[model samples]
Target: MPKNSDITPLPASGPQNKPASAASVAMPADSHSEGGAPTSEIELPDFNDVELNNLISGVKLYLQEHNFTEFSESNLFLMLIHALRTAINTSNDLAVQNICKILINLNEIDHAGFMSLLSKKIDIAPYTGQSFAFTLVDQFYSATITRDTPSLISLNFLFSILLQSDSLFLKQLAELQASGNSEGMFGLLLIAQALLRSSTESLHIMSSELIASLVILILKKNEELINTRLFQPIPHAAFSGQSVLTFLLNVVKCEAQHSNEFNNLLLKQLIEAIHNAPESLVNEGLVRVIKRGPDEGLNAGHIFLQALIASVQIKNNKGVADLQVLLKTLSARAGFNAMLLDNITSGKYMNQSGMSMLVQALMAAKDNEYDLTPIMDVFAQIIAEQGKEKVLSALQQRVKYSSTTYLQLLTNVAKDDSSMTRLLNLLENESSHQETLNPAVNGFFSKTKSEKEAPEEEHKEFTSTHSSSASH
Candidate 1:
């Protein structure tokens, strides 16, 4: 060290700085004086030849004591890039993670450029070199999408990096879709997750076109899977591609349940997609969504109901199972049945095809006693809303069930002279065959509970067998 030479700044190998407000641990360097000025900061001292030699000698001693070997000057310059390459190639996940942490500190390693470089490395990696953008998606999926896993740190870095270039990521997804490779679908799902997790920050990217493309790719891919007839009949254990489907469903649910309007739109698209899917798959997705409970207060169950109702609008023969799902969904929600009936009365739904579907569902589940009170409530509302005659007429034509069913309901809710006469006639006709139905005639025609309670003590003990028999 005869004379001072130029000093290259140290490579950015420490934690990258964020806004001080975001840092969890503040430093003494960050301390402000009482006047809101930074305190006298410790600055790096410039070195002269003698000082540099002395520092070098001290560092040499430290390295020797620490048993560290130093590489040559040029070798050190290229060591990190070479090491990162080796780690990725050899699948040394730990080394790659640690190296990524180091690279993030380099000021020259801007997010977009670093991610593009990293993608090249991933493309050369044997396991994750898929046509899609997320290089390690296959491995991440193989690890079962768990939070605690080996590739987690690497994948998280990749996702954060990818989130910065949303347009490019979406364009890659489109390419993946066009190629129709299964690995591409896997990548597509992972990219969608990244995009969803990203907020509207500087690094985050979410445009309408990007969102639509992602949704279209997902729906198309899921449709292709269902078309294979693997998951038909819904929720079969024999379904071959569990991971892919699980990933896609999670993506849909995450987007759908977001507070954003765009997210809600995604929910609508998913429902419509499921509706148009194979009937068995539609049923399966609906049942599974219903079981999992709501997310964002707008769970899959609600979307399932929307899909079921929308399906009747389609120009096709809806199978009995689909109709049953529709009916079951309606019955689960309060006041939905009345709405359905209103739609029917107003000629807004249940065409000949739809009515047949519904009738089949009702017949299949006539005796299902899950909620008798709700069922009765529907009938009561139907009678009060559409009138007894329209309700009975619609039921007789649409529901091919027992006249006794309609008659019993009418009697329970019916009143007034004209309505009572109509009920009396229907009751007499249904009972003419030998009183196969007595609850209606006995409960209504005999007397009501109010009549019995009116003069109980004054009239008598009121020990009427009729009241006891009717109740029982």
Candidate 2:
């Protein structure tokens, strides 16, 4: 391992000459045709170990002198990339580390340009570029495990670039899984765990992308891998008694407010996983996530509701069923109903689409005889908080298709004076009372009318009894 001093910046001023040995190396003569426009086919030159080392030395000097302006376009830059590739292929860790140090320093100079160049280079020969990237990522995992700060810093700089290109990063993991590279796949998981547990804010920021990618990848694998691997207990101290899935969800809960894309992506994968996996295993995992609650902001419960609403919108019946089961499983927990009610009542979880989905879920629960108490409670609160005008307007929009279900919900929740009054007013103001005259609505009015008359009848009986007693 190189000490910090060993990787220090070169002197501020230096002659910008290629090293003596580097002169022997072949450079692409021109990247443009006779028309003076850049050509699409620029050939990469090969270098032996000695020449590659000299080239790396020269590129290092060039970067120190020029500060990376046009560095990606320079022939020296091309040679540096080839050298790094060769070093990776040859398993030369020292050379790989040195090249990583250069790139890390380059990033400090111009982060955007550095990332742009990295992406282009990866796209040049994706498999080879991925090979190099995987090697660096594995090194990063090792450094993180051993607490090797210097190496971890350099490798994290490289790994962070890979994270920003999530598609490519995921492709690399897919390739590893296809090749039966269990070690490689496991290293990636460990890297995700480490990042999630990292205290450093920047590394922590990168954890969300890595975790989202890992989750998507794991969900795509076979059942054994999904259970034995993703659900296996994490060995880290920070993740005591938690599986990889739980730890990831915990981090996600804290980090979700920072990145909705991550939350949405993971939520989609989890919903799909629930739709596809054996009901018990996936539901168990989800129940555990919900049970732990959020370490901070948005939690798995919120995510579950979001996913459930989305599934309903898409008409993903299997996903909706699985999510509903998970919801029911958590409904009995302390304060679970209140949290859900608060979210829905505050409009945090219910848009027009969300409301329609909730209504649909409520209707299904009624048909299936599942307890609609929690959801009904949520609706009553939404009506109370948002008012009958807004809530009734929202329900009316969905009433055209399922007026029966909509009216049934109105009847079920019209258990109190204020709610019954609002329901009657809403029914009276309807443009057409035909649907409001349905059996359910008539039954609701009859039920309320009978209950109202019972109290008056009881009062008369009480007055007659009192008069009879006085006369006697």
The predictions' CA RMSDs to the true structure, in order, are 19.7, 19.5
lDDT of 1 by residue, 1-472 (tens): 1111111112223112322121211122332223221122222233333333333333333333332112111112122333434444445566556544544443133444333333331212232234324344444333222222344456455444554444444344333322212433435455444443332111223332243344444444443543322223223233222322333344433332223454444444544554456655544433331122122222223333333232222233222233333344344433333333322221112222222222222222222212223233434544555445444333333222222233333333234234334534554454444334333333433556465334333212211111121110
Model 2 gets an lDDT of 0.44
Provide the overall lDDT of each model, using Cα atoms, as 2-decimal numbers.
Answer: 0.34, 0.44
Output the worst ten-in-a-row residue range by lDDT, candidate 2. 1-10
- Residue pairs clashing in model 1 are none
lDDT of 2 by residue, 1-472 (tens): 1011011112122213446332333233433333121222544445566655666787666665554543544445444555665665555556767888787777668665554444331212322223333444555554444444445445555655544543444344333322223323434455555555542233443444544554555465544444444544444434433555654544443443343465555555554554565545553444332222222222344444444433433322344444455555445333333343232232222322334445555544443344456565565555555544444445543232222334344445344435344544554454244353433333334455545343443333332332121110
Instruction: Please provide TM-scores, in order, for all candidate models, with all chains considered together.
Output: 0.29, 0.33
Tell me the deviation in Å of residue 3 in model 2. Answer: 38
What residue runs in model 1 are displaced by over 4 Å at the alpha carbon? 1-96, 102-112, 115-132, 145-154, 177-186, 191-472
